[model samples]
Target: MKKSIALFIILISVFSLAFNSCSSDDDESNDPQVATGSFEIYLDGVLFKQGTNAEVGLIKDNQGNYVNTVTIGMGSETGIVVSGFPATISDVTTMDNDSDPGVNINVDSDYYGTISGTMTRTSASKISFDGTCTKLMEAQVYTITGFVQSTAWEVID
Candidate 1:
């Protein structure tokens, strides 16, 4: 009986050790998560579509909503800065060297934003929003006025 008990405990410890070793706590980017959020679209300095761009914002906010803005470079004051580029930002680290805090910009410089949220193409060249942002039908829409694209929400997922 003592030998059986000892075997059982050893087996349990081995299982626990194996499970912990196999767990993926080492890599954050490679971690698989359900990507879901709102989206906005733009084309050639125009808001041709709001849901065209794949992946809008990173994740839901404190209020359980995804938000991001699509903007192009208008000058030194507008546009979105690519994640790696350094020249495309202001004093704020969140504010890329390109995208502005108050305006969506469309310039030649990397016309893209942070690739967050699950923006898999449910349809070719098309994207959809799911998860924490289902009721964002109205607030997450973008408006194209001539050469400018505008968003009302703080984030554009």
Candidate 2:
């Protein structure tokens, strides 16, 4: 009877160790993917901004819905940040970056205002962006366009 109890305890310990070792946080293949890429901005069909980096991510909201957030940071005092709540990969969502009807932007060392745009999730690992920003402070109206490639969510059968 003593031997049987000893054997049971050993088995339980081994199983616990095995399960703990199998758990991992380094694997993001099955998690929400984050993507970063480069983009260019054209000011009225002319090259105005270049070498800007764009980052995109999908996160869950308080309502358990996935939301899309995008930030484009151009060197200097220029940038465009937008977010769409409760968005999905198959839906096109509109973002008002400046808390109004436009996107958030900064220029000439100042936060100008917002721009209007559309965000599209092309695939599980890709997104497309299109927007028009009018920086009335700088007297410049430009179009912002770009795409980002995700980190590739993986699924284990």
Candidate 3:
């Protein structure tokens, strides 16, 4: 049973890896220079036991630097265990603003998110902020609870 579950997780990760970059109708900037880099996502904040599926991409910073845009995708990863399943996550959710930090690619999700008191990394790569965005029909309040030792990512490519 454990082996089967692991295999299933691996399959899901590989399948998700084939996806294309997010849609940006307009990706034009007047930056002076561009530097490029790579990134990787780890599970439970463990670089060694990272999620089977991680997000890797490049970015064009304002300074004309083209860096790899890395993020944690919606799926099962090491250390994070979803309730009611051996190891699986069902949907993917993302949030982004054209601006930087809180306004730019914060990428909140629904499947599993950072618990409160816990924090997620905002764009620019150091600060942590809300990524688990929720919608309340009546109250319209998003209670974001982050995780402890959650997804730890680094720029590696």
Model 3: per-residue Cα lDDT over 3-121, one tens digit each = 33353354334324322333343254321111222233332344322223333333335784433333333322322221111011222223332111111112222222222222333
Q: Among all windows of ten consecutive residues in candidate 1, which has the lowest summed lDDT?
A: 129-138
Ten residues in sequence with the least summed lDDT for candidate 2 = 148-157
Residue-wise lDDT of candidate 1 within 83-143, one digit each (tens)? 2111111211232212222223223322222212222223221222211111111223233
Find the candidate with the highest TM-score and give its number. Answer: 2
lDDT scores for all predictions? 0.27, 0.45, 0.28
lDDT of 1 at 116: 22
Candidate 1 versus the native: TM-score? Answer: 0.20
Model 2 lDDT, residue 127, Cα: 53
Better of 1 and 2 by lDDT: 2
- Alpha-carbon runs more than 4 Å astray in model 2: 1-36, 52-67, 74-78, 95-102, 107-117, 136-141, 148-157
Worst 10-residue lDDT window for candidate 3 reads 79-88
**Distance (Å) between predicted and true CA of 28, model 1?**
10
Provide backbone clash counts, one per model: 26, 6, 23
